[model samples]
Target: MRAKIVFASMTGNDEDMAEILEEDLLDAGLDVDTSDVSFTDASDYLDSDLCVLVTYTYGEGAMTDELVDFYEQLKQLDLSGKYFAVMGSGDKTYKEHYCENVFDFEKAFLACGAKELIAPLTVENAPTDEDIDRIDQAAEELANKLNG
Candidate 1:
């Protein structure tokens, strides 16, 4: 199976999470590719059997400008039969908006007809050991769902 991870990270935390998740998925025997949101084309999403979105919520729950174009394009695509998962890092101090970008991506993917393989995962600021473990478990579950 093939998976694609697209991410937008400010301060690198979300990028790190994406890399870790990629490793977990790879170890589970799926081929995986990743791209920065600024560099991703809408076709990138269509090319994968599964897609993982990793992003950070900027102030007030906004996604970074780097992800704006790709995010818009994702909304226009028909993602039926694609599986998706969302994970992200954010500052919980924001409370109301913490990790909102992750949820935003999940909602958009669902609207475009993507099926979710796992619930969204959120890390506070950077991923902790527990967060890493959770991500790994999610990846394994995703692999099982696709490869079973």
Candidate 2:
């Protein structure tokens, strides 16, 4: 199966998480492509069987400038039959807005007729071994979905 991973990061935490997930997915023997949200074309998402978003919440649940454009592009597409997952990094100190970008991406995908393959995954500030384990589990689940 084919997959695409798109990410937006501040301070590299979100990108790191994406890399780990990419490796896990690659090892599962699926063809995977990854890009930063700023640089990806909307068609890249539509062409893939699985699309995953990895991003960090900007101030007060806002997406970054790049992701704002990416999200708007996503709103214009009809992604029927696509499968998606969301993972991200955020600080828990922002009680009301922590990892809100992940949910925003999930909502965008659903609005465009994409199905979610897994619950959103969020890490506080940075990932720990526990967080990596969770990411691995998510990758395994995605692999299962692709294989099935």
Candidate 3:
């Protein structure tokens, strides 16, 4: 299976989560490509079996500026039959807006016909060991769903 991970990080927390997922997915024997959302096109995931987005919710429940165009482009694609997942880091102090970008990405993927492979993950800030474990579990589940 092939997987693509596109992420945007401000304080590097989301980037760390992306790397953890990438490593775990690689260990699961899938071919994976990971990139910063600013450096790649959203359509690049069209050729992959799994598409993952890791991002940070900027001030007051907003998508990072870097992700806006990618998000728009993603919404225009036909991702039917592809599997997708969204994960991110956010400040819990934001209350209802915490990790809002993650859910936005999830909705965009769903609207574009991608199937959700797992529940969206939102970290309070920097990911802790427990958060890493959850990400690992998600990777394992994703691998099984694709490779089974």
Candidate 4:
């Protein structure tokens, strides 16, 4: 199996989550490709068995500028048989908007016909040990679905 992780990080929190998930997926024996959202094309995941997005919510629930294009493009793609997951970092103080970007991406992927492999993950600022364990568990679930 193969996985592609595309992420956007302003404070590096989202990037860290992406890295952690990547390591977990690699350990599960899947080939993984990861890149910053700005440099990656949403269509690039077409060849992969799994698609993942990790991003940080920007200013009160807005998508980060660098991720806007990718998100839009992703919504327009056809990922009918693909499996996807989304995760992100946000400040919980934002209350209603916390991790909103992650949810937005999840919706976009669903609109493109991709099946969700797991629930979207949202972390406050940075991930704690428990959060990391959740991320690891997500990877394990994805691997199981792909290899089942």
Residue 83, candidate 1: alpha-carbon lDDT: 94
lDDT of 1 by residue, 27-134 (tens): 999999998888888678888999889999987897666677788898999999999999998888899999888899999999999999899999998888998899
TM-score of 4: 0.97
Sequence-dependent TM-score of model 3:
0.98
Residues 1-148 of candidate 4: C-alpha lDDT, one tens digit per residue: 8899998999888899999999999999999999999999999999998999999997699875678899888988999999999999988888899999999999999999999989998899888999999999998998999999
Q: Candidate 1: where is the Cα deviation over 4 Å?
A: none
Clashing pairs in 4: none
lDDT of 1: 0.89
The sequence of per-residue lDDT tens digits that candidate 2 reaches over residues 56-86 is: 9976887778988998999899999989999
Q: Give the Å error, residue 106, model 4.
A: 0.5
Candidate 1 clashing pairs, residues 3+ apart or interchain:
none
Please give the lDDT score at residue 26 for candidate 4. Answer: 95
**C-alpha lDDT of residue 31 in model 1:** 93
lDDT of 4: 0.92
- Predicted structure with the largest TM-score when compared to the true one: 3
Which candidate, 3 or 4, would have the higher lDDT against the true structure? 3
